[model samples]
Target chain A: MSGVRVLVGTRKGAFVLASDGKRERWDVTGPHFGGWEIFHLKASPADPNRVYASQGTSWFGQLIQRSDDGGKTWEPVGNKFVYDGVPGTHLWYDGTPHPWEFARVWHLEPSPTDPDTVYAGVEDAALFRTTDGGQTWHELPGLRTHESASSWAPGAGGMCLHTILQDPSRSERLFVAISSAGTFRTDDAGKSWRPVNRGLRSEQIPNPTAEVGHCVHRIAMHPSRPGVLFMQKHWDVMRSDDAGESWQEVSGNLPSDFGFPIDVHAHEPDTIYVVPIKSDSEHYPPEGKLRLYRSRTGGHEWEALTNGLPQRDCYVNVLRDAMAVDALDPCGVYFGTTGGQVYASADGGDRWTPIVRDLPAVLSVEVQALP
Target chain B: MIRVVLPAHLRKLAHVDGEVTLDVEGLVTQRSLLDALEARYPMLRGTIRDHVSQQRRPFVRFFACEQDVSHDAPDAPLPAAVATGDEPFLVVGAMAGG
Candidate 1:
C-alpha cells in the first residue's frame, strides 16, 4: 500500500503527519526538537527511509538532524557550516561592503540517487554540500564568487539562498534563487554559476531589470519537464520555457500575484498553484479570504480553489516553503500557514481539509510518497 | 565535580533532566568547564560559543553565584562556590526576542 508522510517545519520544532493513500485520516507526531526553529525538512528520493532536517536557533546556532527510519527517530548529525577561503564581502542594504556570515540553512536538497549526499541553501547567500550524509559540509564557492556578487544586496528577510532546483534530466545543471539577488544557474555542477534573471523585472530595485536583484519568493518545476520553470516573484507570477534563459509574466487572473509559495501538480506538468497574498507589505490574503489559485495552462489563466478554505475573517500568511505536493495518482496538495493550520487537498485543488489545525507557525512543508 | 546548569532548550537537547555534573581536570574557568561539558555532551558544541572563534554567543550569558560573569575572560577563574559545586554555573538565554 502507498502512503504519504508530510514533513512540516515550523517556527518552533518539527512535525510529521502521516496518512494512507486514501488521504483521509492522519496521525500527527512531534514538536520534535521542541522550542527550536525547524527551517526545512525533506526526505531523500533515493531512499524513502532517509530524512534530513535543518534545526537552529538564534542563540544556539544551527544543527542538522537525520533519520534513517523516516521521521520516527532523529539524531543530530552535523552543525558546522564554515565558508571556504577568506569569505569575501557582499553589498549591504545600504550598499556598503558587508562580510558574509553563516546564519541558518533555509533549504535542504538531497541527491536524487545518493541518500548520503545533500545540498544546503543558507543565509548570507551560499550553497553547502555534504557528501557524507549530514556529517560534514563544504561550501560551493563559485556561486558566492560570481562577478556580480559584490553588488548583491539583502532583501527584507536577509540575504538567503532559499530555492534550489536540480535538473532531473541533467546531473550537471542546478538552479538556485536568492532574495534581492536574483536566480543563478550552474551548468558545471557547483564549480561555476551565472545569473539567469534575463526577463525578471523588479520595481523595488533601483534598476527594475538588473541582472541579479529580484526578490523571487519561490520557484517550481515538474521533474518530467525540468526545463519549464514557474516562479512567484514579489509582484508577478512568471514562467520560463527555456530553463530560465528568459521569463514572462503569468499573473493573468490572480486577485493578487504578490504571494510566497508556488508549486506544481505531481502528475500534471502544465498544472501549477499559488497562494496569492494581498501584497508584500500586507502579508494576509486579499479581502481576508483564503483562496488558492490554480493554472491549468501553466500560467496566465487561473481559477480560485476555495471550497474548504476560510472565506472570511482569516488572515494568515503562507510562506515561501510552506507548500508542497505528493506524487500520488489523484495528486495531493498541502500547505501550512502562519496561523498554524496545515491544509490538505487529497483530490488536487478541488477541495481542502485541515490535517492539523494548530501547530507552531509553519515554515516549510515537504511530502514523501512511500511505497 | 563542577555543577553546570544549561538553558532549558540545551538541557532538552542533551537529554538531561536537571543540572549536569562534570569533572574538570584543571583550572575551573569558563573555558575549561565548557571544554569538559562539550567533551561529555558533544551535541552542546557551538551552542554556548562559536565552534571556531570560541567567543561566547551574543544572546547567551553566564552567571555563577548570582553574579553576572558573562563579561569575564574565558580563562578567568570562576567563583569558589561554583568550582566547589556549592553553586551551579548557569548558562542563560538572554531575555531577547518575543
Candidate 2:
C-alpha cells in the first residue's frame, strides 16, 4: 500500500480519506474543523504535509484552516482577517448573509508560486489573501458584487467567491470567479479589477457584459501556459486563450451541456475533466447517467470514462472543487458527489473506481500524493 | 390550523403527497409543527429532526413566505402566514454543490 491521501470537505465537516495508493484499502478520519461547513480542501503539491481548508461556522463566521500534519489537526489561517489593523465588513445583500456560506467554505487554494500565500472565497462573494502561511489575512478589494450587488443576486444556494487561480510564475497574476457575478482578474496585486468574462453568458441580463451575472462556477489554468484557461460556466464549459479576457464554447461533444466543476491535468495541459449533468429543466446526470468526460485535445472531443463506474441512474451533482487530478504518474483523478460517494481514477481517468460510499453529502474532494 | 408544504423529496417520504394541515395551540413553532407532522406521519419522524436532540439535518431548510427559517430557534413562533393557514410552512431541502 502506497500513501495516497484523499481529503473530503463536507457540509458537516472535513475528513481525511487515506489510501495505500491502491484505492482498495483505505482509512477515514474525523470531522476535522469541527461543526463548520467546509467548501474547499487542498493538500499541497510541494509539501504534502501542508494542507489547507476553507471553512465557515454558523456563529463563528467565515475562516480558513491550515494543517501541517495533513488533516489530523488544524489552526485558523488568521485569528481574524485584518486590513490596516481593522477587519473589513462582510459582503452581504438585503441584510441576509450570503446563502452559500451558511456554514461552510466554498473555495480555498494556495498560490503555486509561493507556498505561504493562500486564497479563500467565502459566502459573501469575498476573496481573502494570506501571505504568511495563513497567520494573517487581507481582503482583496475592487472585486465585490459590483454595481449590481443586489440585482445581480445570489442563486438558490446564494453566490460567493468560488474560484481562485494564481499563475505559477507570477504572484501578481490572479483570478477570482464570482458565481452569478462573472470573473475578475488582478494583475497589479489587487489595486484594481476588470471583468475578464468576455464570452460568458447569463440568463437574467439579455445582453451580458463581462461584469454582470455570468455565473462562472470553476476555473482551471494550464500549468505552463499563463494566459490559456478553462472554466465551467453555469450552462456550458468554455476556454480562454487570453487569460479570461475572452472565451469560446468547448462543450459541443459532451453528453450534456450543464455541469459544475472543471479540471485540467497538471502536466498534460490539454487533458481536462468535467461531470455533465442534465441542463436547467432536468438537472440530473445526462439520461440519469453519471460519467466523467475527459477531453484529450481541449474540448474539441470528449471520451466518457466509465470502466468501473455505476451504470445506474445517478443524479447527484459534482461541485466545482470536488473533482481534482493528482500530479502523479499516469495522473490520479478524484471526485466526490452529493450522494456521499467518492470515485477515483489512477490511470488518468481511463477507468473509475469507488473509494468511499454513504458518508455526508460531499462538498469538496482533495488529494495529496505522499512520498 | 397550520399548513405545511413538504418539498418533493420529503413529500415522497411522507407518502401523502402535497401540503398537510395541522392544528396547534398558542404559537406555531417549528417544534410544535414538527411534532404534529410526526404524529400524523410517523414515517417522517427522523427525516426532518434528529431523533434525540430534534435538530434539523444539514440539507433540510425551513421557510415561511420565502424567508429561510432554518436557523430560527425551534421554539420561535412561526410567521402569521404559516400560523393562520394562509401560507404553507415549507420544509425545503437546499440543493447545493456536491
Candidate 3:
C-alpha cells in the first residue's frame, strides 16, 4: 500500500518506476511504445490500474495506447485523432500526412470528476475531449476551430494546445494554454472561449494582442481552489488569483524567468514547484545547476530545494510535461531531463534523489502512488 | 548566415563524422539545405528529408543561429553566412516529451 509507482516517458518509450516508499529504490521497466516517442502518460487517480499513453512515430504518426494492468500488456484505443480528406469533419488519420505535418499529443488529463472523461491537446493546434475513456473522441470545436486560430503561431513544437487545466470543483470550468496562441478559459464548458493574455508578453506582434501568443509553456491550478492558477510563461512565471483574468510575474526570487514547466502541490494550495532554466539564453538550468524552487505562499516567496541533486555543472533541459507531482501523503515530485535522467522527491521538492539516470532523452514523467 | 550544430545522431547517419561543412546554393530553405546535405552525405538522404515528398522529417529538426528552421520553406534561401560557409548547418534530433 506504500509503494509509489513512477512512470517515466521518453523519446524512445515509457518506463515504470516502483518505489519502496521509504529510502525508495525504484525499479524501471519498458521502452513501452517501442521507439515511438511517448509525449504524455497518466495513471487515473480514480483507478491506478488504468494507465493512458500518447505516442507517435516519425514515420508512423500518432496513436493512443492504454494499459489496464499497469505496464504489462498494452492495447491501442479504437478511436484515433486521424485526419481524413474532410476539413471540418473530425477523422483519425493513420499518420500519412506530409512528413512535416505530424500531429503529436502533448498532454492528457483524465477528468477529475469522471474517470471515463478525458482530454488531450494535440500538435495540430487542437484539443480532443474523449468520453468513455479513449474509446471515442470529439474535437473540442471551440478551441480547435476558433476564429483567432489563423493568427496563432506554433512555438518550437508547432502550433498546438499544450496544457488543459480542468477545474477540480466545477468540471465545466476549464483553462487551456495554446503555445504562441496565448491562453483561453471557458466558463460554460468548451462551447465558447475568450483570451486571458492580460499582463503577458507576445513578441510576435508589435504590441501584445489581447487574445493570443504569449508562448505559454505550462499551467497548473490549486486542486482545492480552482480559481487560483500558476503558469510558467516563456518570459515570466506568473500567478492568477482571480481565475486567470490577470497575471503578475511571481518569479521575483527565482533563478531564471524562462522555464518550461511549473506544478502546484496536489494537496497544498500555496506550495508550488518550478524547474528554473536560463530564460533569455539557450534553455538550460542556471550555471548547469538543477534547482527546484518551491513557494510556500503561492509563488510570492521562493526557496531553492537541492538536497540530492548533482552538485556539478549539469546542463540538461526539462520539457513542459517532464515535471509532475504524485498523489501521496507528502506528495511525491518527479521530473526527467533531456540527458535521460529522472529525479524524484518523495517528500515533495525538499530532498531530491535520482531514480534513474543516463538512459535516453526523457520526454515526460508521471507518478502514481500505488493504492 | 545561421550556424547549425548537428547532433551526434544525425552526424553518424551522415557519416564523414563531426559537423560536416556545406555551402547551400540559392535560398537556404529547409528543403534546399536538406537536399544539399543529402546530396553530400548520401547516407543521410532520407534521414533528414522524407524520401517521397522530400519534406523535413518529424523527429529531425533544422536549427541555425538560435532559431528553429524546420518550419521554413525548403526553397527559401538561408542566411548569407550559412550559404557562404561562415557557420555550420545544424541537423538536430529534437529533444521532446519530458
What DockQ does each listed candidate score?
A: 0.77, 0.02, 0.05
Q: lDDT by residue for model 1 over B1-98, one digit each (tens)?
A: 89999999999888898999999987899999999999999988888999888999999999999999999999999999999999999999999977
Higher-scoring candidate on TM-score, 1 or 2: 1
Q: Please give the range of 10 consecutive residues that has the lowest summed lDDT in model 2 chain A.
A: A82-91
**Largest lDDT belongs to which candidate?**
1
Per-residue lDDT tens digits for candidate 2, residues A33-113, read 545578778866666778888765343345566888877877655535332222234335454433222233477787665
What would the per-residue lDDT of candidate 3 be over residues A185-209, giving only the tens digit for each residue?
Answer: 8888887888887878656455764
In the range B74-96, model 2's lDDT, one tens digit per residue, is 99998988888998998876775
| Superior by lDDT: candidate 1 or candidate 2 | 1
DockQ of 3: 0.05
Q: Higher DockQ: candidate 1 or 2?
A: 1
| Runs off by more than 4 Å, candidate 3 | A82-102, B1-98
The residue-by-residue lDDT of candidate 1 on A1-371, one tens digit each, is 48999999999999999999999999999988989999999999999999999999999999999999998999888888888898889998778999999899999999999999999999999999999999999999999999999898899999999999999999999999999798899999989999988899888788999998899888999999999999999999999999999999999999998999999999999999999999888899999999999999999999999999999999999999999999998999999999999999999989999999889999999998999
Question: What RMSD, rounded to one decimal, does every model reach?
Answer: 1.1, 11.6, 12.2
Once fitted onto the true fold, the runs of candidate 1 whose alpha carbons sit more than 4 angstroms away are none
Inter-residue clash pairs, candidate 1 = none
Worst ten in a row by lDDT for model 3 chain B? B9-18
